[model samples]
Target chain A: MNSELPFLVELIVSAFILTGAGFAVIGALGLARMPDFYMRVHLPTAGTTLGVGCTLIASVIYFSFSLQTLSLHEFLISMFLFITAPVSSHMMAKVALHTGVRYVSHTQGRPWPSRTQRPSRDNSQILTEWPKRP
Target chain B: MLRIAVIIAMLMFTVSVLLNLYRMVRGPDLADRILTLDSLYVNAIAMIILLGIFLGSTLFFEAAMLIAMMGFVGTVAVCKYLLRGNIIE
Candidate 1:
């Protein structure tokens, strides 16, 4: 049998490895350099979703090519990451909001998840006496 | 050899773990520290996977999955605590 197939396969595998490594480095750089918590929260979402996703796919591709069969476990793990990282980031953001971390300096008075809990302009008569609840 | 590649990855992971530790230590706020810890989990999982491939076993993959699951739970728990000052509330 000619050896053309193995070289082509190895080249493809090496390409995947390089792509994964690049994504990982970008995620780390985001972690190191984001200006604040909210932005930082946005940063790792990219890492966990795209970076880890790419890395795991590369793992599966490399192993399957080398072993001449599908190595599917990496695909499963990547799916798990896709499900978990967003939930984690959302939870952290909620925590930050509840802890009064202030996503914006000017909008501190608005209650989260709803603006209906506070009085409308029609009901502003009541808050004028209670010091505005802000 | 794959073993050498795995070793190098492990060394890189060790460095990443330490760098995240530095962020955890000096993070200006709790959220930053938590973020760093979460990144540590991702790195740890990758390192464990590489180690498994190097050693010709699938067992470490089990540990890696467990770590990923547990790390998610831990991060949620910490966020809950920060949000409500209690997990149950």
Candidate 2:
């Protein structure tokens, strides 16, 4: 035990872990409960980004206490996951769009929703960013 | 007191694993299932780290690192497959 550490540290770490568990639970719930594939894609972000971040922090603290050594590796992994998961989600969503799978509900009442979806600058930005390959 | 906290962390990670598994089974889309697997990997890594702490050994840290590495590569491959319909073009 780190005699210098306050009692509240344990409670705080436990809370973070539980909060992560909560986010993961909701992500899974949304995955199952959502009506569409796009919606389902949104679900896992709850776990992948925020939940993993919290748990990694808890792990860092736990290991620091036990080994008295910095476990920066876990923290780095959490950051990597946060960055990659969303990038990949965007890729997956784009592929779903290009593959001609119909979205459950598009603002224009069609799967493609071109007019409403296209006018948005972000939409064009994503399209422009995609690698141009034959 | 530390034991109590460690136990709590272990239980929470276990819960996270179970929840992620639920998504893998029931998600409406393949992408969703893939993401769930990624989450399951991360959560499992965290749990293993906690177990290491609880056991007062650093051995599990290496395992966690390996799992994390595998998860990221696997996600990248799946993302590629989703994009091009073939992982190797």
Candidate 3:
């Protein structure tokens, strides 16, 4: 068909789409398979960032070449996803910590304050940032 | 060539969504379920974008953008609710 895309363009677009979908699938698999909440939290970043990034690029190429006009608007969604994914993951991880979700026993180093040293509700006693041990 | 590729991509995305669903349903904790939900929405976005490419429609872009915004807000609100009993507080 005369209207079809050239072979090289088709190949490139296909490659991009496949790569994106592959990353997304792996990310989802990681989410399902990770042993702990923290590990699960780290998994979906692959999907939200590189996965979406590659797919959006493919869409840009398809629409731009097929329509014979530039279509940069898709970047808006990609950028939004990039910004939001980390922030959401961070929030989720923080909540996980606050809730005392189980962690791997062999995890190295202490990050958050130990559960026994709960911070007081009094505003005057609370530090601006990291809590200090009494 | 492109058509076949789009089909395969769609299948892969569907599998990912199903995996997310499995995690959401089998969660050992509330936070784990919510995190799966987060991944679910992102996977959904990928699916919609793939569909748009297959159908050659620009209309899907708006839907994808809206989903991204709403999904982020929903996740943040839920996480806040988990951290603090009240979302507004």
Candidate 4:
């Protein structure tokens, strides 16, 4: 199998795979190391977007070359991932907001609106007040 | 070179899965656990794709697609439940 693949194609595929893997590792590292839920929530987008994208691109290139036919099916997974990852993350963020998950001290603006506070016509006043530290 | 790259990628993905597991277990909040599970499935898809490439087969794409669909639905469902206290309303 190795001998049949052209040297350049192998190099390209290897590079893509390694790049994707690297992004996934970095994203996971951020997830593990981040100090708060809000900060951690932002990290996985890196893995879901570029990391999966590179791997699928490598797959498309490798299969298309080796099979002598255009292999475009991998794009389906990529498209689905692109569409769904953000939606899932957004929903998760909403969950975090509704549940009032704790955030680090430095985060600007109130992380979650208080349930007792009525929606005011002028929202600027809400943003102007710093949250009291517990 | 491709073979070595696949091995290294597999190892990296394994590490990623482990790290996600750590976050899921140690996360102080429910949202954190749900978020970790979401990324964990994505990492699993990546690993499956790598395995398919290593074996020189196209069969795994279907499984990966199914996982992608199911993972998204599951994440959304859990998030909705957490947000609204009900899966369907």
Candidate 5:
């Protein structure tokens, strides 16, 4: 029933936190240094997903050990982040394309479809219709 | 040992946030700015969670959760406006 954490637990938590911070820094570096918006957009996934994941795991372990109860709630944040990060990134990329953000000169890909075909719909029309308020 | 780790991690995260802020301000394009804003919030949440661990307080979790939700909503709304030129139409 001792409240003090053992050495192993502290080490594990420290490892998680350090790893999380490292990933976050790497992600931010990519965002700042990348040559194009599309490349920059892909970088923060490192922070939003794995960076948060490691820190949350650290938090959960630290709390559960301190409180002597199985504290699993930090997972909720990571879960929500996991669900939202990709979607938010996708939306940002779409906006970038819709607004005609320029790619780096050497970026290899087919030219984006002209905005005339449809603004909301991509070539595949993944989201053909806007959601209506019920 | 843990204290040192927390200090180092927090320093790194602060630098990360600053990098995101630089991109947001220096953006040559609107979408690039928006993307940087989105990444900024996410990095902020990581910083908050790290703070929680450093301070040994669970209260910050609620703040982190709220940031996550609001950040997603804000990104979506802005992206929507950029895409369609109107949020509600």
Candidate 6:
């Protein structure tokens, strides 16, 4: 409905928007279908990073062209998402590791090291020093 | 074309949100639920942004940004709580 925008700009914007949405849907499908917690954890990063990134880019292009001004503000959201998505995913994965969430049998690492039998000396030292509060 | 695309995109995002909801409800592990919550907020932000674009208004950008910040902080805080059993320590 934005009449001011040219045909090519509209085409580009729509393409990007559709692509982003498709990616989001695919990611969500993976989240819903993945067999294990760790696999499910990997799916959302696809949505948060690339899916949102494409939509943000489309928004930037649409607004910048429509308003006849540089609309770089969406970059803030994009950058924030890019940085935080991975961090949050990493943290969640850490929580999974700490909680010993179950994984599929086909997973390459069949048996994760137990807390008492950590693979590294430094990690063992840290685990030993870590207080176990009841 | 653009309007149609926006409408379709909105519907897809809605479907995605619903999928996330399903995962959240059915997740067997606490970490799984938390991860679903994190992605849920991100999808919500995308929906807000799409709405803003459809309406040709910049007002929703701030709301999207706020959601981004708050979602990240909440995820991190919850993760910390799960890891150490205390958020601030």
Interface C-alpha RMSD after superposing true interface residues, each candidate, one decimal: 4.0, 2.9, 1.8, 1.0, 2.3, 0.9
Find the candidate with the highest DockQ and give its number.
Answer: 6
- Point to the candidate with the largest lDDT: 6
RMSD of 6: 4.8
Q: lDDT per residue, candidate 6, A5-95, as tens digits?
A: 8999999999999999999999999999999987888899976568889999999999999999999999999999999998999999888
Q: What is the C-alpha lDDT of each candidate?
A: 0.66, 0.67, 0.85, 0.89, 0.84, 0.90
- Tens digit of per-residue lDDT, candidate 5, span B49-76: 8788777888998999999999999999
RMSD of each: 7.2, 7.2, 4.5, 7.5, 5.7, 4.8
Listed in order, each prediction's TM-score against the native is: 0.74, 0.73, 0.88, 0.89, 0.88, 0.90
Q: Write the per-residue lDDT of candidate 2 for residues B1-89, one digit (tens) a residue.
A: 76676677577667657766776776655666666776677677767766765676667767877887788788778878766547878
Docking quality class, candidate 1: acceptable
Q: Please give, for residues B1-89, the per-residue lDDT of candidate 4 as tens digits.
A: 89999999999999999999999999999999998999999998999999999999999999999999999999999998877668999
Which docking category, incorrect, acceptable, medium or high, applies to candidate 5? medium
Off by over 4 Å in 3: A1-3, A111-134
User: What interface RMSD does candidate 5 have?
Assistant: 2.3
| Model 1 misplaced regions, further than 4 Å | A1-5, A102-134, B1-15
Alpha carbon lDDT at B70, candidate 6: 98
Task: State the lDDT of candidate 6 residue by residue for B26-86, as single tens digits.
Answer: 9999999999999889898889989999999999999999999999999999999978768
Query: How would you encode candidate 2's per-residue C-alpha lDDT over A1-134 as one tens digit per residue?
Result: 34455667676766777777666666656655666667667767655467767777877776676566776877667766777777767776665565444456543344454432344436676689899999
Pick the winner on TM-score between candidates 1 and 6: 6
Of the candidates numbered 3 and 6, which has the greater lDDT value? Answer: 6
Each prediction's DockQ against the real complex? 0.36, 0.45, 0.68, 0.73, 0.66, 0.84
User: Candidates sorted by DockQ, descending order?
Assistant: 6, 4, 3, 5, 2, 1
lDDT of 1: 0.66
